[model samples]
Target: MSEQQKTVALEAELDALRREVQRLRARNAELEADRGFPGRLVDALPSLVYVLDLEERRYVYWNRELAELAGGNIGAAAGPLRGDGLSSMFHPDDIGRIEGYRARVAASESGEQATVEYRARGRDGGFRWFLERGVALGRDPEGSGRRMLGSAHDITAHKHTEQMLERSESLLHAFLEYTPSMMVAVDVEGRLLLVNREIESYYGMSREELLGKVVYDLLPPAASASIRKANDEIAAAGQPGASEHVLVYPDGPRNYLSTKFPIRDAEGKLYAVGTVSVDISRTKQAEAERAEMQRRLIEMQQATIQELITPLLPLARGVVAMPIVGTVDPARAEQILTTLLEGIAARKARIAILDITGVKGVDAHVAQSLVGAARAAGLLGTRVVLTGIKPQIAQTLTMAGADLSGIVTKGTLESGIAYALRARRRS
Candidate 1:
């Protein structure tokens, strides 16, 4: 073993070591390049990417997207990434939610996935909705080495749309609940779908309890048949119709006028029936009142005609006695005068008694009718006798300037009749 031999062996060994180092360095360079690609790709992505240190509950690696989102570098952000509780980017309102999600994620096993929606501050200094999805990368039994990989998406527009839909639905519900009119919507089969507060209160049931019940089930048997007929008509016609009907409620009988129509879908196929009911008890009562008034008017007209025509028949004996009752308006005055003149001419009577004992008073029109009747009787070769003048009647007749100089007078119908009979005998 010589010095030359030792030196040669050492140089060979050193060469072998150097080759191994070169191979290892090449593998290291490949691995570094592979890692750099994903990092660079993540930084260039539009959405934020993060690697979270679960044990510390902070971001371990953050991309440029997150840096820009947070309005600062990832390490400097005020949230969990900066080790300052959680990101100040999170809305104060969403802090509890983020913490809860983090706890849930922590409790899950490695590779477990979770998602959460939270509010994050945007670069524009406004809060925007964000959806974060996280997968557990690893977990430490000691609770210090847990980690997660996550990505976040800006869901501001989607959240805003959801909020708008919620508001619109809320408004529709409120409108149905608060409107004063009794409104109801039913399926084509007459199953109740929706009813307003008024209907619920009127029917003495909650809306939830009443839904899906048949309309007929809530009504009395007598009313159910009629309401079913109306609903069927509306469905068949696909048009609105209104009618009044009597309903027997738990409270008692009531009159209701209902307007009903079909509700159509987008394709114009009838889907449901909608109805608005107005309580018409008052209106029905008013109609009854009008009918009574009309009946009274007809009765009065008939009675007046009878009274005027009956007395005229006896005028043929050369004398007639007529009794007037009730206050006389122009209409009655015309009837009386026309009857007396015609009677005098037909009967060829020499004397006729116009009795007013039953009369309360005479207006100017009545006085004129009486005067005209007397003059007409004179032309017919008849003498007119005015009788039964109360103090008020005399005053009214005098004030009206009626000429009664050619007429005889009596105080009552009996007296007028007696005078007429005596005059008839004398004739």
Candidate 2:
């Protein structure tokens, strides 16, 4: 080849090489820009970002976010870290979990990722929940060896939310336990789901043991049927209903007033039934006593009217006599006067005898009542004979200064009857 031709070929080669060098420089600039962009963004990010070398078992590369989290700059944070050294920040309680996760990551050689939630100690000496995720980078070209790159994300907020929900549930259960009335919750099928402490007496069993059992199982057949019917109605209506029932417990039957209502969810769907029972045994007993007293009062009134009116039904021309017994108090005196006056008018008797043969004693007020009744009878045209005055009664009458001037007195009921008959004949 000629020298000049070789020079031309060299120049051509030089031009092509220069073009290639310029292209290479442009590409390098783009790559540098991209690298610095990601690095800066990652360093300034609020969340920690990291790459783990599973084989070395340490954080390979970390951003400034992680460095700040470790209480240092990136250089200082990475200086002491070899592979797998990030485990040092794991809480003691989570060390076993971290070791297990590391083992899982190392064993995974298929380029797949492993994720776990674990606790890590912050620089502030507090533990934070983290979700650790790792994937094998390139331990094997066929993805059959363990070489992992991993990152952890803080999930403390989510953990806190879960813990708060658990606490709220515990508080609710505690409140139910301490409530006074017997409270119970049952599923749609009428199986008991929850029962409060007060239900222990009603069911005759521990609340724990009663769960999942049908309410009918603890009640008498008749009472269970009635309660079940009411519950069904309330559930169907999605409202409240109340009933009084007798619960047969181990101790025996006890009365209770039970109120039942349906429990609904936010969307207005029927979920379960809630019930509260109040002990009404005392109130029931009081009501019964009131009823008995009323009945006795009615009976007494009827007996009084019957005794006063029965003897007057058949009127005769002969005399009618009323014999009173027992100590004569003011109330008894009033009753005797009322009976004698009413009987004289009813029977149209010309003469009537008021005998206190069995009377052992009398007060001054009673003697005065007797004299007044005799005067009232005389005005009604029926001659009154006051009979059966014993010695004591006579003494009391004298002491009372009661005027018996026109009242006829006899010592015995027999004499009074005889005197009444003679007076009736004379009239």
Candidate 3:
């Protein structure tokens, strides 16, 4: 009875063990399917997945995406990339960066991660930008990197956009810097967001010091206020306007013709003010100098004309003859008197003959001027002999109540000269 019972129990135990083995195999199959699902997902992804055995300094695995991009399995024994180094895939300009990032990730502790963006050359002879992220996966026995898991995303489109933006900004900066005028951009709050080289040089400051500073911080109070007002008007009107500004420099006061306009975004909203200040100091100073020179030139021309009109000529010893030609106004009359006295004193003339043969018309001022000249000459001990007195002029002078009775009058210049000679003989 004991042998039979033992045999039956053993058979039952064997059956239960078989069932357990079958259940365990089923569970293992399920777990393998789960793992295979993730592997399939990785292969199907657009991003390239890879594993690097840093201990051996070689890439251990790469997904299908990388194999397709590289034209072969990156890790397969018969693949085109089988023995090639990972650095060969990178662009020459990016090799150093890729190598540096790899080294940094390898030196990091487990679970450490790093990201880098670089250009990778494909088998198609095209370069594409990749934003690759690497994670350290534990270390080897020698305290060196064992494995690194990384994913590379093709960021070529994003990089292109970034480059385009950078180029646009660079072009704008160059245009502003090389412009002849001082260009400045300020936000609505009056903070300086951008300034050209001219502005920096004009203010004697650097971009770092000027940027983000208020407009009033760098300029004189009056200039700042004026600029602010102009900016406000431009912003309010959404149109360009101009104003004059004076900036005191180390050398002297400099004038500027500033044109200010509003800068709008794509939505046509005013966000900044653009100012272009053209230096007008030299132009203004030159104009002022030209005007002064013109004044001096006019004075010189008048003096030459006056000398031409009145000439006191020496006729005989101690006698001077002056002839008035053309029209004689009060100024010319005064000039005539001055020249007569100077000649009389220079020649020590006791007799002076005044000629008016070319006289056209004589006004009251001219009459008074003649009378005044005679009295002045008499005081200098010179007897003035008036000549070439037209009857009409004499009547006009007499009717005008001009007192010329003390002056000796002659009808002709020849008579005056004769009388002067006779007077000289008497002297």
Candidate 4:
């Protein structure tokens, strides 16, 4: 046959098996001219072509490719294969489906074809996927097809690639849907390309509404400005940007920590941007609460120290004395006066003693505070006695013009307590 005629004949068989009925009709007229050409051409085709005996479950006629696929060269004897021969090469999981496919093909109409996908075990013991197009070569006497012509192409690589893509897509979908963080992908123009379920739920927008919307338009003005600045920073620096922003919702303002990064092509050119945002309002509230608690605790501690610095002791039933230690500020001096009067009222004390032995240099303000304490004690039916006074503090009180007329003086705290007890006995 001429090359052009050979090419035409080869395409007719390899590519036109789906129209096997029409091809078989024309094949009879060309059989004499084609002679051995069809056999050699079928053997040269990439796919495996076979005419099977459906009733016996064996190949009646197959190409050289089927022989190699069926392990003829590896171990099987060099001849036409026998009973259960071709069916045994199919995977165990698919062995049942093969019988169904053959039954369907046998029952098919003259021009109809049955397409099925199945895995078949190769000679090397690995299973490979096959996409087969089979049809009835001829029908039996009972109006059922008994012979089938099939063209099978190996599709294992395509199947594996599709499976991997599907798995990756499923994993990405699950992460976006279930993760707590809000994630979004936007094109360079700031249009939203992808948004997770969390993002949609957080913003109270449906996926249909959120998609294709500009991210900047959806966010509050301040938040969008911050996001825009962060995007610009990363775009210039070629790194990810992280920032904290406040978004005002219908309820209130919420704090969010967001990280923005560029999605780049393999050549390192930016194409889009991705953002992951997490709400930090609870964390900020916790920090504020901790700080407030610390402030309150410090105030409580200072109040406790004020009491510890000036401890009022009841020397007798009708008298009390407080030994003031350390330097006394006006605030502490006022605290001292308040404690003295309260102690006198609570104990009904007639005599109160102030110990200034531990007092540092008293300023004019502190001296006046002490003088006021003496006058206030006297009004409460208590005589305020100054005890353990240093000479410099006495000089300071005199120089400050503090009145000492009603206030009694003593050399020591023990002496003051003795005088108070004796005075109480006399009264």
In model 3, the runs with Cα more than 4 Å from the true position are 1-68, 72-87, 92-113, 122-128, 135-150, 153-186, 192-227, 230-269, 273-294, 329-349, 363-372, 375-381, 390-406
Q: Best by TM-score, which number?
A: 4
Q: What TM-score do all the candidates reach, one by one?
A: 0.57, 0.52, 0.62, 0.64
Per-residue accuracy of model 3 over 1-427 as CA lDDT, tens digit each: 6999999999999999999999999999999999899878999999989887766666667788887776533534453232245556678898778778878888887787899999887657788899999988878777767778889999989999999999999999888879888889999999999998988888778999999999877778888887788888899999998999888888888899998989999998999999888999999999999999999999999878766778778888888888887888877787888888887888888888888878898898887787788889889988888898888888878888887766888999888888888877887
Candidates ranked by lDDT, best first? 4, 3, 1, 2
- For candidate 3, the 10 contiguous residues with the lowest summed lDDT are 75-84
lDDT of 1 by residue, 1-427 (tens): 8999999999999999999999999999999999899889988887878888876656778888877676554646555554453467788888888777877777776667788999888888888898998777776876533777779899999998999999999997888887766789999888999898988887889999999999888887888899899999999988899977787667677898999989999998998999988888878889999999999999999977667543564744677766778787788777787788877777767888888778877788778887787777778877777878899888888898988877877777677777778777877
Which of the two candidates, 1 or 3, achieves a greater TM-score against the reference?
3
Candidate with more favorable, higher TM-score: 2 or 4: 4
In the order shown, the candidates' Cα RMSDs to the true structure are 12.7, 12.3, 9.8, 12.3
Model 2 per-residue lDDT tens digits across residues 183-300: 8888888899888888776666887789999987777789879888888888899989898878766766778898999999899899888988888887999999999999999999
Instruction: List where candidate 2 sits over 4 angstroms from the true fold.
Output: 1-48, 54-57, 73-80, 83-89, 109-116, 121-125, 138-146, 168-182, 188-192, 195-243, 259-262, 266-268, 278-427
TM-score of candidate 3 against the unseen true structure: 0.62
Model 1, residue 231: distance off in Å is 3.1
Alpha-carbon deviation at 68 in model 1, angstroms: 2.9
Error of 2 at 350 (Å): 18
Model 2 scores a C-alpha lDDT of 0.77
